[model samples]
Target chain A: MADGVAAHSERKKTGNVVEIGFTGDDAALVRALENGHPGAPAALFDRHAPHVRRMLVRLLGHDQELADLLHEVFARALKNIAQLREPARLRQWLVGVAVHTARGHIRARTRRRWLRLASDETMPEPAAPGIDPAAVEAMRCTYAVLQKLPADQRIAFALRFIAGLELKDVAEAAGVSLATIKRRLARAEKRFVALARREPPLEPWLAASTRWRDLRDDDDGGDGGEAAR
Target chain B: MTGGLQALGRVAGETAEAVAEPRAEREIAAARERLVGAREGTVALGRELATSQDQLLAYPGDDTLARARQRLLAGRRRAAGLPGFVRLAVPLAVCLLIAVAIIFGLRAREPQRAATATAVSYLVGTRAGTLGERVSAFAPRLGAAPAPELRFSDGSTVDLERASSARVTALDARGAEVDLERGAARVFVNPRRITRWTLHAGPFTVHVVGTRFRLAWDASTKRFSLQMTKGKVRVEGPTIGERQLVAGQRLDVDLSQRVSRAQTAAAKAQPSARPLAAQGASGRRHRRPVRPARQRLARTTRARRFERVEPMPAATPAPAPATATPAPAPAPARPTTLARALQHVGAGRFCQANGLLDDKALSATLAKAPAKALLALGDAARYCSAQQRARTIYLALWRRFARSPSAAAAALALARLSHTKGASALQLQQAERWLQRVSAANGASAAQQRIAAARRVELAFARRQTRRACALAREFLARWSAGSAARYVKQVAVRCKLTPERKRR
Candidate 1:
């Protein structure tokens, strides 16, 4: 890992010296890619995959989906490398691709709901209750309440609170005014608080219940220290 | 409520104590360790995916690469066979042929359609910003207002005043009925068609073929009033009244009461023989005879009733013009800059006004303006353009502001710009780095989301896994379908074979 990081840094430096503007190295990578250099694409993938994977995990709410998506993102990036205009902004470009791909995923899910209303799977139950039941319940309630908000508000709230992004970043990502983001967050917070109060603490109870204990016992190894904690 | 508040207070206090108390330091450390473990797990998984992508791409003589190369070669061959001249000409010729075919096809089919089918007409003008426009856009249109006494070809008459935001959905041989919601409208139906006309508002229904009556409903009040202006109307069902309202008469249908009241107030309000004109029918003839005496009595009664209502206070006269310096009278309109033009555009109330301006407007708006305002307007235009899927506008904005020192705003815009087609992967990576820099510098909230969303799209394409691609596409679509990125979401979904489904509550 250290060697990979060093090599990546060295490539970045060499690439940076070759070009003058913001995406100098990226441009060189594109040129190298066009010339069929072996390391150009690998370096690009290594640099950006982590950020993209983090985003996918947060977005899809599942590890398996994120893993699958991360692979696809890089492969498509390599295949379409020749089409890239600015190599320096490759990370952003990849991110854009992920966003587009994720959007398609969401749209398809929405359409499938009508055909398979009962078949749609619920979120997976957490394996063990290491975290406080109340906190877990809070998180579940937060997600449920968030689902009720308008798309823009939900995006802003998620970006702001769950992902812990700054106001300006949220605004930019949402492509709205700071004022608008503020407004959405305010409204979302109000609705979330109201919903949290009104809904019973079902998730908390479930987490604390004996069924959860048994499930944890079955899933964990014979030693139950981690499961109990 | 108090109990709930106390519980919340206790929870907050506990959390605070957990964080600040020295005794809990070990617990906090343990929690941090757990969090680090989680992060490390995620990082390891990400590394594995990255390594796999690298290996796949690096495979010697990979079948996927070979296939893609073959496809490209075939595409090139196909392109070469068509001479440049023919290549251009064929597309033009095909387009012209298709256009002609469509025109002729429509023309040939036109005559077979029914002649009296009325095209859907919008009665409430949409103004976008105003309450009326918002209401009309958000709320469903009820049925059309019925003429005072003239029955439509479909034999339905509606009360115009009680038919606020109503529309005529169907007018055919079966007769017509007015669908109304909140607001008041009066309808006058031809007596001959009385049995065929109907009035519907919320849960209440009134059947009439020939009647001149007013229907008023206040959604807030939950009260419905139906007053006859001419002819007669019979109430049935929930409202069981067999009263006939003559000329200069009124009837009130209390849907909640199941009892309607007949009053002679109509006669006391109208003195003239003039009748209210039906909406959207400039030259339609009145179907009911005018009774002048009863109308006169109705007018006097209405005048007296109006007198009893409180009069609006008169506006106070403006302070006497300053003797020394009268405010300059407004100057005649003058040619304006892009900013001024934007203001005008704003006034026009187009949803995509900022996006509609030419590059000249952008430069002009930015010139001499504060950086913050310029950035705000640019951001707004970027969003507006994104919503409209105006690629040219986004490109223009990027070219103008990509490297500016506006920090968060410029970097975010650049990231979006670099993500578009025709941009190289290297450029996109740099854009992502810039976004990360911005996030680190200013802690912008949307950067992570934007980065995440973009990454998901990239990964899906890289893997060529249709199911995974579809799933990610749906997630993004659900979040952005109502935002400025809806069009991009649609494009991605179409490419990925993911159809967005409407969210069910």
Candidate 2:
């Protein structure tokens, strides 16, 4: 699993050579995309796809159709490149597109559930050969709880906690004001905690986490974080 | 926690070299600290999930990006193949469909009843909800940050400011009646052919027919205040009965003190009023020194409908060696100067008032004089069209008493005077700086703060700082989305082309 993840980074380092690399800043890339330059799409993908993919995986969990969803996100971005309001903020805009894509997929899955066609377990497992079982179970349990949340709240929570984006970035990705995102994250956190408590597999982790948090609180004398900002 | 857990899990089996986010763990740890006081189980949940960030963020394979790029470029190729008109067809058809629906909907909907009055009130600012939500009559409209506004169907609006509460008591075709139970509310009644709106605050009743005013009632102190910004209204209350307030006038009724003062622009004389002793029937500026007897008479008759003259004890026996009364009075030199300035201003002799409140005397008394006196002198300068003198006095007031309750008013006055017609860019910039001062004033009135915020947006837009204007407009809309000026702010937002997130970003 480490090799696979590390290999992805390695491939990018080498892939820059084989591909006719079109290197530019975000604004230049946006111009390229808008101009329909032949290599713009690949250049954009190679530059931004990793962050978008990470955001999507955090937002939607480990789904089998992740690749297709990633494709759809870039496709939408490529199609609407000219509509990007601030070319300087292309990364944030792309993250927004990914969040939107994940939200749509979550809604579609929910609709499928309403029609009795799919379940949460229906997502095929990713083929990470040497991943730890505990890590895998934690991921599964976390996303299972996320499944019960509203799509918007889930996006906010996943982008904030799982992807470790700043609050403003999370808000940007969710296409909401920072205050609105805070409110949604607040609701999502409460709901996620409640749902996670119902899952027995997460009990030990929750207990350990509580103990760790208490110790950290005592150690730091309890000040707030960049989250508030 | 995420990094720590990843390391622990690595010790359990997986390698530690591929820990994706070491710095992210620090941030997550800080974020989890905010969840410490959250509801039970929430902190633990945030902690557990935050610790699993590495597991959750799976790096995508090279094939994914390659495949996505191919599809994206292919899609772009297909889109290019389509004709330009065909590209516009879908949106045009949808717009046409919406237009037809709107037309049919309007035709099918019953016409609004002329005898019925309707209003929708919504909260704005940090806790803002939908921009427009219908509020039933008699339902109390509560204020929040920045304020809550009740928008009437007739384009009128009532903004509840500073923890205020109000409700519509009676609504009808002629207009609606709003009762301010407590706190302050700024009302703007749209001008109509037969507009009739009445506002009740405590024992005071303000009868309106196409006007804009701010009415406040403090039940604890039994104080009722009205500041008429535009048009006119008739206020009936204790101490002041049926007082007519025109544009740029303010009335404050204090039941505690049994005094009601009406502050006017002091430039216009009341209709059918007796002429001032100095200024004859010709309405010409007069320079004759007014006698004490006629000054008293002028204050009595002129203040009856215009301003309430509160005589300062220091103004008495100014430089007069009187043998009748012998009380140790602090040197009456500067105090008498300020008093005479106020007396001239109260008597509607603004030019005389400005002449008395010169730069040297004003500076000498700026610290000792009460903020109210300085404000009065400044207003007199403004009314007298002495913009430079008014600017000096207002700027001094703001600088000397920056923390006083009157500082915000002084700043606001300075801003308005500096940004007057034909103001240079430098003056406009100075006006913007003064507006920022008002906004930053700790003890500033909510109304003043709201006005400053709105003006800041407009000033920025006028100065071609579209980005700042858009940012300020978005902030103003966030807090005062249901406000009277929200439409203009939204227009500014549209002109700047800022999306909500991007604007905030």
Give candidate 2's total backbone clashes: 1
Query: Which run of 10 residues does model 1 chain B get worst, by summed lDDT?
Result: B310-319
User: Candidate 1: misplaced stretches above 4 Å?
Assistant: A1-42, A75-89, A114-121, A125-138, A175-180, A199-229, B1-505
**CAPRI category for model 2:** incorrect
**Strongest candidate by DockQ:** 2
Residues A47-105, candidate 2, lDDT per residue (tens digit)? 88866776676677667666688888888888788889898999899999998888998
lDDT of 1 by residue, A12-103 (tens): 34554531111226666566556555555555554555455544433444322444455566666667877676667665577556554554
Candidate 2 structure, TM-score to reference: 0.33
Docking class for model 1 is incorrect
**Candidate 1 at B256: error in angstroms?**
43
Off by over 4 Å in 2: A1-21, A120-124, A211-229, B1-62, B76-505
DockQ of all candidate complexes = 0.01, 0.10
Best TM-score among the predictions, by candidate number: 2
